[model samples]
Target: MTETRKQLLQELAAKNGTPLFVVDHEVLRNNFKEFREKLPDVQPYFAVKANSNPEIIKTMFDLGSSFDVASIYEFKLIYKNIETWPDKERQDFIWDKIIYANTIKPFKVLTKLNPYKILVTFDNIEELKKIKQRAPDVGLILRIRVPNTGSMVELSSKFGAHPGEAVDLIAEAIGMGLDVEGISFHVGSQCNNFDNYLQGLNFTHSILKEVALRNFEIGFTDKEGKKKKVLDIGGGFPVKYTPDVKSFSALAKKLNLEIKRLFGKDNIQVIAEPGRFMVATACTLVTKIIGKSIRDGKTCYYLDDGVYHTFSGQVYDHQHYPLHAFKDGELKLCATFGPTCDAFDTISLADELPEDLQIDDLLYAENIGAYTLASATDFNGFPVAKVAHINRENI
Candidate 1:
């Protein structure tokens, strides 16, 4: 952090009050541009579940980015942006720019999504049946279980069908008079093992080949009048949260080479759901120390935000955002806790901060824009962080 940045944060905190979340749209645009430049062939669907702030969604919309929504509420958030357009234009935008990426959706959601006729993902037979009966108009993408090893969050156990059963499920969907548009897979969230992606691509290739052998015609025709198959290489684009984490540029290079080597000649529309990569580093959280004490000869500081609020990402996303003090002093091991009564609200017991820091002093955490506020709760009568936008002007 620079002195200018620290001064700005302090000013923002003074004006907006503590437990403030600052979103920098300029950073958001740069992240989007980086993703596009690195992987030119793949279209990005900003995962709405990552941080469904309407302003963030609008920014992504303004950048011409597609969306991957997990629920009907999220679907409507994207729809809110285009509701004023003509009916044809609205529907076209929905088809082209939105995907209900949640593999398991409820019957009511299926019936609700049927009118849009957009693309959706499914992994099991029950979901397929529900989609066939309740939402037959939508396009389908089969999600196969791939290696989630060494990922920050493992998703294969809960989502994705076994790769071995992928083709059979596709065949069954087609037999039921439903359109199986393509195949999709998620290596995992914040994936560290790049080989997991390679294996996922190989699985998709083999499944598509088998589907071809079975003479099952999948995919839809694009405006170019060419038949194109949808190859949704689902979200797992790693973000460099720390120095040890691998770079997305390296992964993109590998993906470009492997995608071309395996399906170079195929008419495939490759897409990805990038949730954390887009917003993690684009925002920062500033909180105020409400109390100060000493425990076991170690300094303890309590903030207005905790695990149930702005710092919830620490508990849910398995990420650690080391808090920093604006005042310069010798650093020592300290404890940080949230405003909540439960000890479970502890942010960190090993946080390093100056021992002389006093109450009402400001501390901020960077790279906390992704999952923090999205999952926050107003537990113990403590309100979630107030969000303030910076660099929000159109670029």
Candidate 2:
């Protein structure tokens, strides 16, 4: 926590809105710089799908961060904002090169899109043919095995090509004159082990090395084996959402070295599409205590923000939110709950908190900027969470 976070929490409590998404721009900037420094030459592509707050995206831009977006709407968001820049001196916004990470892309979307703007991914052979038929001139990186191996945060569904299928897909795409540039995968979200990156990158290298033997000689179509263009290993860089999250700086350092070691340091540019690390700690959810109780030797605090709207209920990782004890001052044990009528709208199931909790008292839950907002919806007419950008940097 920084001085800005402390002051902002105090202010957010007084500010109107029960369930609010308050972002700390300064905190976000620090995280952004950390990614830039650690990855060195890697294009730190901020995943907008994780936390699509334009304000935070602007903060990233100020810190010289590139982005990794999914949909055309997301890519359009970048274009919408880019209009504000001085056209006389154009800035190189990476939106032009945002990866279209959706494993199953539609032919309609591909045909309508300017080919160079999207780095399309395909899992099935039909999808690759669709890309070929619709936009054959485009560059693509086959999304390899949907990792049952990555972070257990959001269960990455089996959406990409199977282990042995990636090379085949690449070969077919090249036969269609499509540029099969590289490969990518997700180890997990909120990934605890930085070595997971090395594992993923090394795995991608192994796969690419195999693709090199495809006999679809680039610069000479009849020849076999060719040098690859890029290796884009998708991101799951962890942020300190809770005390339990182990920092893998040593692991990350080793992974960086390994990436340079295996990928020849200069010819390949690694792309880290970090979502949570970019925006998690940068924002906090300010939810008010709506009700409270005790059962089976445990305390429960029902909050205005529920799992339906926050998705914290479905989160099994037990994300430790830096719960604040204010209004009634001092601290004691209390479990947090959500406002939803569902019996499972529990936020803090057995978490200890200040016994001073009272109705209307505020709890600033740190690291709420990522999946919560992106996955939020109105259940039982519950309104969308009000969002606000707050930080010492902004002040």
Candidate 3:
């Protein structure tokens, strides 16, 4: 970070008060642009569950990005942007620009989503039956289970259908008078293992080929009347939170090459749900040291934001955001804790910082945009951090 940016963060913290989460819209745009540049063939659907801030969604909408919503609320958040468009335009937007990616959705949510006829994902026969009964008009994407090895958060254990059962499920969906648009899978969140993606692509390709052999036609026609099969390589695009985490460029190169080798001749419309990759590094959190103490000959600093608030990502995301002091001084190993009463609120016990820092001094963490604020809670009566955006004018 430059001195100018650090100074700006301090100014924002002072102006907005402590425990402030700052989002730089410029960074968000740059990240999205980079994703597009790297994977030109893949359509990025910003996963709203990562950071569902309205402004972030609006910025993404302005950038002509699609969305991947997990719930009724997130669906509404994206729909709010196009609520004023003409009836056809609104329906078209929902069909082309949004995907309800959650494999298991509530029956009420299915009923609510029926009118839009948007694309939704399913992994089991029960979900297919629910969709057929409640929202038969919606498009279906079969989510198959794949390897999630070496990912920060493993999701395959909870979601996705067995690869052996994938074909059967697709056949069942088609047999039920439903339109099976395509196949989808997630490697995992913050994935470092590139093989997982390759395996997922292979699985999807095999499944589609088998579906064709069975004489089952999948896909839908777009507004341009082009029949395209949707290939949703679900989210798991890794973010470089640490030096050891592999670069996205390397993954994109592998993906581009493998996608072409596997499905280049197929009429596949590739889309990706990228959550952490887009907003993880575009925001920062500034907190104030509320108290100082010494135990076991080690210094401990308590901040206004804790595990229940902005640092919640540490617990939920399995990632760390080391805090840094604005003032320069001799560095020493120290401990940091949140304002909460529970010992579980500890931020870091081995933070390296200046021991001479006093209470009310400001500290900040970078690349905390994803999963942190979205999972924050108001435990111990401490309110979540106040969000302030920069460079938000004119998109």
Q: State, as a TM-score between 0 and 1, how close model 1 is to the true structure.
A: 0.99
Write down the worst ten-residue block by lDDT for model 3: 386-395
Q: Estimate the TM-score of every prediction.
A: 0.99, 0.85, 0.99
RMSD of each: 0.7, 4.3, 0.8
For residues 1-395, could you state the per-residue lDDT of candidate 1 as single tens digits? 88998899899999999899999999999999999999999999999888999999999999999999999999999999988999999878988899999998989999999999699999999998899889999999999999999999889999989989998999899999999889999988999999999999999999999999999999988878899999999888888889999999999999999999999999999999999999999999999999999999999999999999989998889999999999999999999999999999999999999999999999999999888899999999999999989899876
Q: Which regions of candidate 2 are displaced past 4 Å? A: 1-4, 83-96, 146-150, 154-157, 215-228, 293-299, 311-322, 327-332, 392-395
Residue pairs of candidate 3 with colliding backbone atoms: none
Weakest ten-residue segment in model 1 by summed lDDT: 232-241
| lDDT for position 257 in model 1 | 99
Which lDDT values do the candidates have, in the order given? 0.93, 0.68, 0.94
Candidate 1 residue runs with Cα over 4 Å from true position? none
For 1-395, candidate 3 gives per-residue lDDT tens digits of: 88999999999988999799999999999999999999999999999999999999999999989999999999999999999999989988998889999999989999999999699999999999999999999999999999999989999999999988988898898899999999899999999999999999999999888888988889999778888899999899998888999999999999999999999998899999999999999999999999999999999999999999999999999989999999999989999999999999999999999999999999999999999999999998999999999999775
